[model samples]
Target: MKTFKLNPYRIGFRTIKTAAGMAIGVIIAKQLGVINFSSAAILVVLCVKNTKMKSMQAAWARFASCLMGLIFASLVFELLGYYPVVLGLIVLLFIPATVVIGTQEGVVTACVIILHCFNSKGVSLDFILNEILLIIIGLSIALLLNLFMPNRSRELEDYKTNIEQEFQLILSEFSEALKYVDIKLDHRMIAHVQLTIEKAKSVAFMDVENHFGRNDNSYYHYFTMRGEQALLLYRMVGLINNVSRSDQLHQQLSELIHEMSQNISGHDHTAIRLHDLYAIQLQLKDHQLPTSYEAFHSRASAFQLLHELENYLHIKSKFGSLKK
Candidate 1:
């Protein structure tokens, strides 16, 4: 038999925020003298989300559905009589109604409101106002708490640093692989770089979602640029690993890649790199035709590698221009 153990240190900021938000919502609702004041806490629990847009969306859906639910319940229950069967009918009809209106996120909350309506025995303006107040109190507290999410920019920056370092290491390895055919590239490191970029992109996207008013996010753009470069790097790795032997051209490209690896960062060095790449391309054009099939294949791979490198720099160049 396996025993389950909880890692107490696993609690995160969201947990803390939710707990505090629930308490505040309940207290405020009770102070407002609203019936079923604790439902406000439930609303807070349901509405808080990892991103501001999601939280806002949940809150809006819940609020809208709750209102619609109340209206549907008040009419159907008052007219059809508040029987248990009537309650069931309301749940049946109201769910589909909410779905039709695209407020399905609030279906649970709406059901809660329906129960309140059923228990009231009759629908009155005062009763409807009370439910509205409860929703406002709960959802407002949730939105407020969600607004205090910890800044993830620092974490994103750390991911950026890790990704750049990994790229540097990978490129340095590529340079070595060029000079020595027997050198084996670390597939594990390549995998790690891909994983890191994905994680960073996730964080960057979350950062973008956190800012409701901002149309542009630099971190997102940075990760996107890195993601494109990573694809190029993966292709280059395969090409470099297949190179038959080192020659003057191969050595020159290797030296250039080494320099590029040294300068990998958020800064724009694409213009300089592109100039050097063009020089290398020009040199490639001046070389005599390969006499052997292996030499031809190697030269072909070198040309592809050079093209990939040029594209990699162009991606950064475009990104830099956009940033300006």
Candidate 2:
């Protein structure tokens, strides 16, 4: 079992936004003389999200559901005289109605409106308008705060740089392993890089969500490309591990790998590398046929390793062209 630790100093931007928005929203609502003004803070807390799209979604759902809740509460309470059982009956009907309307995310905010209606002496136009004003005030403040989303480009670039560095190191290590068959490749490094790519993908997705009008997803696609290439690397490691002996082809491939490691980056240089790789392939094909069975196995493994490396380069090539 893992123990949970709470760090007091680790505050997130979303947390700061929620706290500040709550205070500002409630103050504005109170100044506007809206009833249940403090509930404006609750709305702010509920609507604030890590991304602008999500905050907008929550605000819309809350507004739509609260409107429906007002209709339900006004009719039910006005006819039934705001009895406790009647309030219970409203909950039973309101929740399902919210789900039916696809505004279940607003259930809590809508219930707050319903409770306000129940607390009033009677359903009057003034009180209904007041609740509506509160909704507008709360959701407006949330949207306003969300308009200031922190730019994630730098953070995403960092992830990209880190992933490229990891790839460079992995390739360099693989180059060493090719030259010396006894040098065991660390599989964990590949796993860690894949995990980092996944994390970076999620951040990229959130970044896309934050930008309402922008549609470019180059960052997301970049991480996806790296993830695919990481799988190729993992497969190449397995192929390298299977080789029982090193030969001239192994040395050539190692040199190619070292060259690739030096050039590893976000930019596309796949065409040149592919050309070099194919030249090596030709050399292997025309080289003296493996004289022994063990030699044949080693040569076969090298070919398979080259094939995986080719696919890896092709992945980046396609991604680079698409980026352009």
Candidate 3:
């Protein structure tokens, strides 16, 4: 809320900067008695658009765009203004149309140019000056309103939570992905893999964007951790896919998953089912005994290994070690 209220003023300040342009405009406009208020109002957005370089980029972009627009608009409108109503309305319409420009620089420049076109008259020299004064008023109001808004950091945290939840949603799809693969290991399997991969990458990007402001090391570390977690899931899926397609289920892969699941679900190491999965993997790999997925499924093991693995993997990735 505070940022919201202050945002308007910041925008106005940007506008005022453009209109005044090193204090000369403000001094001259105030002195000449041709000051305008909206000048500063538009500059704020230009600065905001360049906020990627930590607000400095925005400031420069805003000022440069605004000034260039003003210069161009002033010249064009001067020639066209012989027909005041048509020229004035056209200029007015053009100014606001720039509102949807989607970038700070574009919007600010458009704003200034439009203002020049709309307000230009015998007071061409005073146009920028007048705008500079109006900028102060708009900025001040925005500043005052935004003074006590809610904590922006907290809002960022909420966004972070949402991103994490979206990541989890991808994780939840894994079992479905597996079951689908079990039915037919076709191109559809690749589609699920791509979806999960993209979703994980997006989560990593969001975390990077929202986690650290300018501190590079911490930001990299956080993202690196997330990448590691994502890779683990990728590894797990690869293991499961192999089981579904292999002529004979691979023993090591099955044993690893079986042990990992037991570790995940907090199931007893001695549980009959967990032991049986290990035994099944060993027997199948060696062609020693029972030779089917159905036989493995029919046994009433003490705990479901796959379920335990999924839950544990999710918990470990999203949170800290469950061992604690």
Total clashes for model 1: 0
Task: Please report, as a residue range, the 10-residue window in candidate 2 with the lowest summed lDDT.
Answer: 315-324
In the range 147-244, model 3's lDDT, one tens digit per residue, is: 22223344334434443444454444443444444532233433444454455444334334432364333323333444454455544554454444
- Per-model tally of clashing residue pairs: 0, 0, 19
Query: Candidate 2: which stretches are off by over 4 Å?
Result: 1-5, 266-268, 290-296, 321-324
**Per-residue lDDT tens digits of candidate 2, residues 1-324?**
999998778788888899999999989998887878999999999999889999999999999999999989999998888899999999999999989989999999999999999999598889889999999999999999988888888899899889999999999999898878579876899999999999999999998899889876889988998999999998888788766554668778888889889877634567788999999988875777778898888778988999999999888888773342
lDDT to native, each model? 0.87, 0.88, 0.43
Model 1, runs deviating above 4 Å: 1-9, 266-268, 321-324
Tens digits of per-residue lDDT for model 1, 147-195: 9878997898799889889899899999989988789775677778888
TM-score computed on alpha carbons, candidate 3? 0.41
RMSD of each predicted structure:
2.1, 2.3, 11.7
Could you tell which candidate, 2 or 3, scores higher by lDDT?
Answer: 2
lDDT of 3 at 155: 37
Q: Mark the 10 consecutive residues where model 3 has the least summed lDDT.
A: 297-306
List the candidate 3 regions with Cα displacement exceeding 4 Å. 1-59, 76-104, 133-251, 258-324
How far is 213's C-alpha from truth in model 3 (Å)?
7.8
